[model samples]
Target: MKIGVLMKQVPDTETKIRIKDDASGIVVDGIKWVMNPYDEYAVEEALRIKEKKAGSTVTIISMGPKRSVETIRTGLAMGADSGILIDDPALEGADCYATAKALAKVMEPENFDLILCGKQAIDDDSAQVPQMVAEFLGMPQAMVIDKLVVSDDGKKATCYRRIEGGAKEVLEVDLPAIVAAEKGLNEPRYASLPGIMKAKSKPFKEINLGALGLKAEEVGAKGAKLKVKKYFLPAEKAPGKIIPGEPEDAARALVKMLREEAKVV
Candidate 1:
């Protein structure tokens, strides 16, 4: 089986983000970058499937600035056979739809048997790309998959996913399907020294919008249907107020504060 996993590089959650002066985007300077956390789950699942079904190959794909190569390398180090980096200035500032369109273009010739992606990227949290990619490819798609298993013939797979009211739904899909993996599917493994060394020797294909026969107007901010008008840090949290006394007194004080100050009681 040839499985393709879509990965993304995002600012580390710990990094302090600053909006650009013009409000066009965030200032990414000096911010540490890492693989999207949710994507890690997808990669891990792919690796697990490869392990279970020996002879399977896992390829990672990512689209972003040059720095995103590091994110691809991270996946390679985790045992993905190879990677492709779709780099182009035109791809910058793209929203979910444009990004998905670019990915679909690149994946058209790969003849992949499966496509895996995170349920949502942490940076945008839009949760739109996977479905869009599936739509572009005209493939069946399963979202928020918590568990998965492939049939012995590798032609069909089953998945358990979360639904409304905390229900779990089971789906059976044929090969060449797209699945958006959720957290807790499996624990991801860290890259070892040997894996890292081998990753350096693996193929890393880089393609640009021009190479893909796409125009600048089809990607980036111009193609994005949504726009960010402003960006700013959230307001600082207020200090907590403590009520000290016996349980009865504390409860009374809490009730009084809720009724008078919060007006929620």
Candidate 2:
């Protein structure tokens, strides 16, 4: 079995974000970057699958700027066999569609039996790329899966997914399908010293748009069907009001406020 994991580098969730002066985008100068948290879950699942299947290899695939190589290396340290980084200026501001197209191109030759990725990237939270990649490859896609069991022959997969109203859905999909992993699937492991050292020599390949036979105008900001007109921080929330009075009076006042001022009742 050959499994492909789609990874992404994103700003650390704890980092404070700043908007650019011109309101065009977020300030990246002082931000710390790390693997998208959900992507880590995908990588861990891929490693688990590789362990169960003989003669199996897990490949990490990503598209981002130059620094994305570091993110790929992190996956290598997590036990992925190799890494492929698609770094090019033309993909700077590409939308989900353009990114899926580029990634689909890179994945064509590999012909993986299964592809896994996070449900969404934290930065934009679009939750669209993996499904789009499946569509491009003409394969079935199972989204937001929390549990997965591959057949002994590696020809099919049974997946468990969470749904609305606290229900779960079980699905069976053929091999060579896309699966978007959700949280609670499994806990990710940290890379040890030896794994980190081995990652340095792992098979890592970097490719550009031209190398993938993609045109400059067909990807990145140029090919994006959606564009960000401006980016501004949301307005600060107002402080809570405290009613100072007797308990019974306060309760009456709160109900009055809810019925009148807040109008929530």
Cα lDDT of all candidates, in order?
Answer: 0.92, 0.95
Which candidate number has the best lDDT?
2
The 10-residue segment of model 2 with minimum total lDDT is 215-224
The C-alpha TM-scores of every prediction are: 0.92, 0.91
RMSD of candidate 1 to the truth, in angstroms, is 2.0
Model 1 clashing residue pairs (backbone): none
Clashing residue pairs in all predictions, respectively, total 0, 0
Write down the lDDT that model 2 would get: 0.95
lDDT digits (tens) for residues 165-188 of candidate 2: 999999999998999999999999
RMSD of candidate 2 to the truth, in angstroms, is 2.7
